[model samples]
Target chain A: MKADQTLDCIGLYCPIPIVKIATKIKDLKTGEILEVVGDDKGIKLDVPAWCQATGHELLGIEEQGGEIKVYVKKAPN
Target chain B: MAKKEKLTIAVLSGDLERALAAFMLAVTGASMDMEVSMFFTFWGLNIVKKNEGTMKSKGLMKKMLNMMNRGGSKRLKLSRFNMLGLGTWMMKDLMKQANMPSIDEYIAMAKDMGVELIACTTTCGVMGISPEKDSFRSEVGSLAGAAYFLSEARKSGVTLFI
Candidate 1:
């Protein structure tokens, strides 16, 4: 999915990737999409769980080789 | 977004891994727009001590206890596979390689994220630790007993003991 901002979380582990995504999402405007790419296996689950918990919209996820890309839309204030 | 949720974590262990987990949860909860509070008691109080080695305590027993423990985040050992601190060193190196923040950095992040760090007053009194003696970290928000933590825990959406 195309996004307004791309955050690279390569090499980070669980919680850190989620933490970074949460922090980065704050910089984007409400309804803007954020594309997060990471190598951490936990990202696939963490991103969706984070979105579900925080009320953000998880657009989709794509996996290529060992890398994963997740798109999340910021929730309105 | 839903209403702001609350998370209360009781940090009861001083081990590196446990401390790391508590801080990780605290920061994540805060990032998710939750009000997070960490209650430090027993060995967990070590994580909030100033790393400076010069903290002095009165009385022979207090001095002995201080010398044996030398409480601080940097001196924490792993609960298992410590290998006399070698394993902890290796684990920290791996964490650094993964771009993970150290425990101290996590403390700073928690502070920046507005996570409350509350020291256990009961533990402090029992352990002969005087918070006013400049032993605890300045980031500590308040000194409260289990009653305060329990009240907060009762109101929290999620409460954990680590």
Candidate 2:
């Protein structure tokens, strides 16, 4: 799937990847998509929880090699 | 526009690790556009102390505790196996290896994200630490009672004690 932008959070740990996602999402327009790349242990739960809590849309999550990529669509206010 | 959900975290411990965890949550909460507030009480107050003039509770025991916990967030004792401060150093090194933010960096991130940092008024009194006299980091706002913060916590979507 395509995204408006990509955030590479590889090598980062819990809270950092999630925090970056939260910060990055603000720059996107409503309904725009952000692709997050990370492999943190918390990402499996944290990314989905973050989207659910913040009302963002989780498009999909795919694993490539050793990295996990999360696609999130910004939600309208 | 709809109202944003908020979180209130009550940091009740002075342990460096728990305080680090608390700040992580605060930053994450605020980053998602949620109003995040942190209430620091008892040992937790050490996290907000400035570089100098740490307050100690009266009596030798409390004084010794203060001596052990002198450096604020910069020099916090680990909750377990501190090893004469070596454990904290090892943990810092581990965090660096993982590309995680340091405790000081986490505090900075929470502040930058607009996390409301409030020191507990009663704890301040119990420790004989006058908020007006003893210095604290600029991140900390005016002191408040538990009742006030508890009220805020009650209205929050989630509240954590750590």
Which candidate tops lDDT?
Answer: 1
Candidate 1 vs. true structure, TM-score: 0.95
For B1-162, candidate 1 gives per-residue lDDT tens digits of 466899999999999999999999999998888999999998998899889866667777877777787888999999999999899999999999878999999999999989999999778755557755377888898888879999999999999999
Q: What residue runs in model 2 are displaced by over 4 Å at the alpha carbon?
A: B53-71
Which candidate number has the best TM-score?
A: 1
Taking all chains together, each candidate's TM-score versus the true structure is 0.95, 0.90
Model 2, B30-139: lDDT tens digits are 86778999998888987888766656456776576566656478868798989998998898888898898987888888888888889888787555456552457887
Alpha-carbon RMSD to native, per candidate: 1.4, 2.5
Runs of candidate 1 with Cα error greater than 4 angstroms are none
Question: lDDT at B135 for candidate 2?
Answer: 51
